[model samples]
Structure formats: C-alpha cells, structure tokens
Target: MRIGSAASLDELFDLVLEAAHEAVGYESASLMTVDPAGDALTVRASRPGRLVGTRVPVGPSISWQTLERREPIIIEGPADKALGTTYTKDVPFSICLPMMVAAKTHGVLNVNRTAHPGSDVPLFLRILADQAAFAIERMELYGDLQHFTGQLLSQDEEHRRRLARDLHDGLAPILVSAHAQLQSAGVENEQVDKATALLRRAIRETREILGTVRPATLDDLGLVAAISAAAREMATESGWTLEEALDDPGPLSREAESTLYRVAVEALNNVKKHAAAHEVRLALLKNEDTLEIDVADDGHGFETEQWGEAGVRPGHFGLLGMRERVAFLGGLCKVQSKPGEGTTVRIVVPRDRLR
Candidate 1:
C-alpha cells in the first residue's frame, strides 16, 4: 500500500514499516511517533509487535540525532554502544531514518538486520520515510481543521442563542407591556386606537424574529415537533400541500438538534422561494444507526450542478451553508433537482453522533 493512501496515522505507520521491511528484508523494524513535546518517542508499530507502546526518551541517542539532523543514520557491526543495551544491542547493522516533512519532524523509522543489507538500502528507506512523513502531516492538518470547524459551529450557535434570548426577554416583553397598557387605558380616540394596533403589530413581528433566530419549539417540544411546525407554517404561506412523516428521534445533543433543524428549515425555505410546485413532502426516519431527513418539492427545478459552482448563483449561499452545517456534524447533505422536475434535499447523520 502507498503511504499517501493511508486513511489514519496508525495505518500509515504500519504501511511505512512494511515498506521498509520489504525494501531491505530487515530482521526487525519499529516505527516510533514523536510526542507533542518532542522530548520522547513511542514505538507505535513494530514488526515484533511486542515493542509497541514502548517509550524512549530523546536523549543522546542515534534516533534523537537522526530526528534532530533530519537525516538517516546507519550503524554497521554491533550497535550495542550506539543503541542502548535495551534496544537492538545484538543487531549487526541498523539504520534510523527521520520522518519529517515541511521542516517538521513527526517520528523516526528504525530497521535492524543481522548483517549489512547493502549501501543502496538506506536510500530506499529514506524515500519511504519521506512519504510517511508527508502522509502523517496531512492527517494531522486534517484533524486540526475538524477541531476548528467544531469550535466555529459551537460559537455561532451560542451567538444565535444569545441574540434570540435578548429579543425574547428584552424587546418582546416591552412591546407586550406597551400594548397591554394601551388596551387597559381604554382610550376612546383614533390616535390611541392606531397606537394600540401598531404596538400589537410590533409585538407580533418581534416574536416572529425571535422564532427565526432560534425556535423555542426546538427546546420545548423537540426536533420533530419544531420541524413539523416549520413545515406547516411554510406550507400555509406558500399554499403548497404539505406531507410529513416525522418519527420522533427521541433526544439529541443541543448541537445535533440545532444542526438538523437548521438544515431542514433551509430546505423548506428553498422550496418556498424557488420550487413553484403545489406540493411538498418532509420525512424524518431512523434507518438502523442513521437518522435521515428528506424534503422534496414538485417545483420547477433547475440544474443541480449549479448549486456548487465557483461563483455564487441564485440560492447557492443557502445551499452551501446547509451543506457546511451538516458536514461539521459528520453528516451529509444532498440536493437533487432537474429542469421541469421536482427537487429533493436529503440529510443523513449518524445516530451515535447525535448523542
């Protein structure tokens, strides 16, 4: 297997070791991962298997020197003096290759043999170590990206919650109180009546804004009820026949619930705005270990390829936003549409991740 094709760090390490063994036919080999502090190396994968998890400090050793110099070190004859008695003392020859890429050292790969393999073996081992290093670096960078995305989504949700709370607890109540006072005064003037009507309208609009920011039904009732309420409201406004088959997904983490709810609402909004169809269907179901949300509209759909083009097009931002939101939760969002045909937006998330 190519080191670059490795899906995980562990798999990469194993592949690197296997490649080294195949290149030189070493009697024993070990792959060690550098700790975060760069102060020690731990044997993550070894041909003998028993050496796995063994930790060695990065002192004045050949492995440490190789990592520091970012080069390969070859030791011929007995390595008892170079490598401590605890490691490869009786091996007649050995090579330590630094696994490094972009000036960052990831670990060291060591191969030991009972006799000298040949001068050319070190070159092959160096190339293998370089590939392994690049793969390891890529995996670490991807992990960092995932972590950053999670944090960004969490912060965005918190901001939305705060804004919704202020509108509900601060602005909405003031409008309600003003309207109540006007009604209680029983003013018998045209101006007073108009003022009361305006206040009532303001209060209603404020509540709508609050709901749009963050729906209380999601927190009070659950995801299913919130989605059902949203779909019904959209259908009523759009004069579309609404069909729902929502199965209560029990409970979910706040983040999971919010992500799914937002995606569903976005899909519905797209249908209301773009899909000129007379009917729409929304379904929520549990398929074994996965939860799925489907929204379909029999509207005048466009080419689905235009959804994720280079430049922004009509409805591209919303679709991209929905996809990103679901992706952050390790879920998938798919939109299918064609001219003269309807559009279907499907989202699937792992059940375990919901918790």
Candidate 2:
C-alpha cells in the first residue's frame, strides 16, 4: 500500500481516519493527535465530523493503554465510561491502535463498530496506523527543517548587514581621510597621484560592496524601492528593456523585506547572466493578503525539467536558493519556462506571515 504523502497535519489525520474506514470497516472512526504536552489527545478528524476538537486526557482508558503499551487494544464490551460520549457508548466493539514510529507514540486511531471485526482486522489496522505514524513523523521533521532554515537565513542576513555597516562607517571613512591627506600634501609626483587615485577607487569599491552586501535603500525605503534599484542596475548592465509595475507593499518586517529583495535580485542576476533576451518585466504587487514579486524575461528559455541539473552548473544555485528562501517565509516561488517561449519567476508570500 502507498503511504506518506500527506501535506499537513490535518490532512494526515483525515487520511488516517479514511484509511482506517477503508482498510477495516468502522461505524465510526476518529483520529486523535497527541498534544504538545503529551498529556492528552485531541480529536482532529472524525468520520461523523462531530468529534473534531474533542480532547481526551491521558487516563485509565483503552486509548491511553494503547499509547503506553505501543500496541493495539481490542475492547469487546461496552465503551469505556471515561470516554463520556453516547455515540461511543452505543458501539459495543472498538479497537484503539497506537500510531508509533521509532518506538515513539504520536497519537491513537480509534475505530468503533456495532459488531466485531474480522480476526485479521487488528493486524491491518496496526499496519495502517504505523504508516500514518511515519507520515506524521516525516511532516514534523520537515516543519522543523523549515524553521531551522529560516533562522539560519535570518542570521546570515544579519551578519551581512553588520559587515556592511562596518565597511561603510569604519573602513570607508579611513579611505576617504587617506585620500584627502594625499590631496592636501601639495605633491604633484606621479607616485602620489597613483596612490590618491587608488584610494579613490578603493572608496568607490567599498561603497559598491556595501550596496551589494545590504542595500541601505532596503532599510530606509522598503522592498519596492530596493527591488527597483536592483532591477535598474541589472537592466543597465544587460541592456534589457525593463518594464516595471511596482507597488508599495507598505511596512513589512525586516526579514520579509530582506528575503523578498534578495530573491528579486537573484532573479534579475540570473536573467542578466543567462537570458539573452532584450526585454524584461519586473512587478511588485500586493494582491489581497499576498505580496507578489514577478520577474519575467523574454529570453531563450530552457526546459524546466533540467532545473535540478541546472542548479549544479556554475552560478546556478541561486535558482534553488530562491525557492528555499521563499519557502522559509511560508511562501511559494514558481518558475515557468519553455523552449522558444520565455521565463517567468514569481514569488508570493502571505502578508500576515510577513508580520
């Protein structure tokens, strides 16, 4: 049997309940998710749909026994009075299966019927419960991964901002002072002129580095302004006819603004380096509760099927990194391209999440 592709915790619960009903018939079925405190189980999904949100504390009940024993518990008599439900009380036969993965009980799957199920039903239910447990475990691990990645990205950006500030405030001023001293020395020697010229270049390059590291426009202005600045720079360098439809997204958290700006810059850089087109369209729009940024290029497109292989090429990891960054913000990054068509990179993030 296929297993383990449920997207969210709720969906996993519904799948487990549905699978229980299909694999072994049940008059009523419910999936209980273990609370974070591990002291109770909450009915997240049920076949009758009325038991949702019902909470059952860990007590001397069959469900609790199944969880503790890490096995299926078959009850042939009246429903446990601790359940405190007329629907459960009416059902004379029930089975509570522990959803265990790696010797850890995540939850319990309860199935009730008026008559006893076949002798092999427990085995099948146990298998189904195990699969559901594995899916839940995988989903939890993925959630943890996304949280860690978000933290790492935030820290990395903070480090870059700090380094940029040091260069702008600490190093750039020293270079400027050196240049001024050389100019005031009243020396027309070729060596002095060369030294002064190098100092000026260094100052100029330092400013450029500061801009690239963390653009001041991003913090002072906002995401739209920062993206427009980046887009114009890339357009000038690539000689692409740039069309922009930027809208102010109002105030956003520092992290959200930074993530959007970096993703936009990466998209533009990819176009400048790889796309041999003459036209590019950049858009920053706030639609409903979402903030969207789109970078489309009328370039010679390649098969998107090669996206994975392309990421391995030199200077192409940005494509994958862009997606990961957006995902970290609970957003989506979509790349649509076809040969002889064009390429469009769109990122949509929930506005509330930005806060």
Candidate 3:
C-alpha cells in the first residue's frame, strides 16, 4: 500500500504478497518479476510460500498476454484450454496484470482463485497491480540513475585519453620546436644581453608547458619510470617540490599508464594553480589487486563536491576530466581537499582491467 515509503526490499516484498492474498483470496498468490536472461517471469514473492526465483517459462504463461496487452486478463471459468492449461485447470478464475512504469511493462502480477472470484476480485487485483507498478517504476528509476552515472564516468575517461594524447602529440612538439627556436635566437643575439635574457625566459616557459604536454611516459616506459620522470619535470617547472614512490613494474597496461599520467598532471597542475603549498607527493602503490596512483598536494585545498561536474574551471580544466578517464578504465578517481589544508587525488583502476 504505502510501499513507496518502504525502507528495505523485504519490507516492500511483504507489502506485495500481503495485498495479493487479501484481495483475490486465491489458493496461493505470488509475484514474479521480469527476468531478461531467463526470458520469463521469475517468482520473487509468494503468499502460500514461494519457490524462490521460480520461473514460469516465457512461451505459455497467461502473464505474457497481460504484458503484451498492458491490461488486465481474465480467464472466466475456463480459458478455452489455451496457454497455462495445467495452471488454469487448478483454478476456476485466473487474472493477470502487467506491472508497468511509464507505460512500459516490466513484469506481471498473477492471481488465481480456487473458488470463482466474482467481479470484485478483478478490481482488487487492479489495486495490487497499481502498488506493484509504482514499486517497479521506483526500481527502474534507480537503475536508470546508476546506468547514467556509469556512462558519464566512462565518457569522462574517454575525454581525458583524448586530452592526454593531444597534450603529447599535438602541443608538446609545437612547444619544443618553439623552445629550440628561442635558444637559437638567444645564441645569435648575444650582443644584446637583454634580448638574450628574454629568449631564455621564453625557453623556460616552453619547458614548463612541456612538463604538462609530454607523452605519458608510463606507456613508453613503466609506471615507476614514468612517475619519476613526471616528478622531475613538475619539480623543475612549478617549483612545487614533489616526492614520489612507485612500486608496480612495466607490466601495467597502456590505459593504466595514461590514467596515472593524467592523475599526476592534474595533481601538479593543481599545485601550481591553487594549492599554493610548497610541496606535493605522488605514490603508485599496489594493495593486492588494486593499483592506486595517489597525488597529494600540500597547498590550500577546496571542497571536492563543490567542484561541480568533472571539476570546472577555465584554462586549467583537467581534474574533472581525469576522474572521468579513471572511471572508463573501470577505476575510481577520488579527490580529498579541504580549504587551506591540502588536496589529494587518488586514481585506482581494477587489476584485471590492467591485465
């Protein structure tokens, strides 16, 4: 009745079975939810006791007709000896109702009466069906939310992979070439020391950009080597000293490499952009089956939840993107940050996925 306010699944099942029994006065009343894999209705709850997960084959149950028509089905007296011949024989009147949500039927609510269920039985069956339909809608809505979150997380990871590739192949080379030209010009204009100083500054800028642009070294090397290289570069450019401890060897996958690389890049960038802290720590540790890449910044931190979807910011919009990338690889990306305290980003991908 008030099942929508149910606190537990068992509580909700109790409501459905109790209503089915009181209304139709059937010898037994049972609830069968749709089973996609079994391609039939599998009993979930019953009044006279259930054969838990009992399946009524898809082909011949009168439930199929109710589901197909999205309406109540009544087999008065005898059902013309049609589908469910054996089941119909045991009961004088059979009623089936399709449980629906948003006009889509998910399963059927079946009621059978050993004694003829007069017209009132049909109306009562409708009430039980309504309650069940609401419950199914709520469940389906919850399922939709889970599916959506998964998809969003997946899409984010794909975006990061593309961003990482762009930073490496697209921007890194351009900046490197610019640095070479600046160095060459500095050599040629030594007579003008001020001009030479400007060239040197430009070269330093290119190096800083390279720190973020370089290809994920983990993919080329392994996790340890890649993190080590990234640590050196981030230290050199941002002046935010970083300490790193890497464990897993060259066996990690290309996707894992990309994931760790993105995590470091985002962590270092946060240090330079907002952390204001003087140092950071990067660790790639393995605890049994889970591989965790941890990036901690000593700088001032902010509320992780308030960062909005995928962490929003202009010019330096990478953290949210990094989380998305981690999710796609069947991994989790978590950021722990408190204002004026510190910030830590953890990217943990499944070991099997890496394998």
What digit string (tens of lDDT, one per residue) describes model 2 on residues 165-274?
77668977887888888888989999688778767666655554553455567777677877888889888888999999998887788878777888898889888887
Model 2 lDDT, residue 119, Cα: 81
Alpha-carbon lDDT, every model: 0.80, 0.80, 0.67
RMSD of each: 19.9, 20.6, 19.5
lDDT of 1 by residue, 239-260 (tens): 9999989887877888789788
Q: Pick by lDDT: which candidate is best?
A: 1
Every model's TM-score: 0.45, 0.44, 0.40
The digit string of per-residue lDDT tens for model 3 on 76-142 reads 6667565554454477777787777666676777777777767788787786777677776666655
Candidate 3, superposed: residue stretches over 4 Å from native: 8-10, 76-78, 82-84, 146-355
Would you give me the overall lDDT of model 2?
0.80
What's the count of clashing pairs in each model shown?
0, 0, 6
Q: Any idea what lDDT model 3 has?
A: 0.67
Which residue pairs collide, candidate 2? none
Superposed by TM-score, candidate 2 places the C-alpha of residue 25 at a distance from the truth, in angstroms, of: 1.4
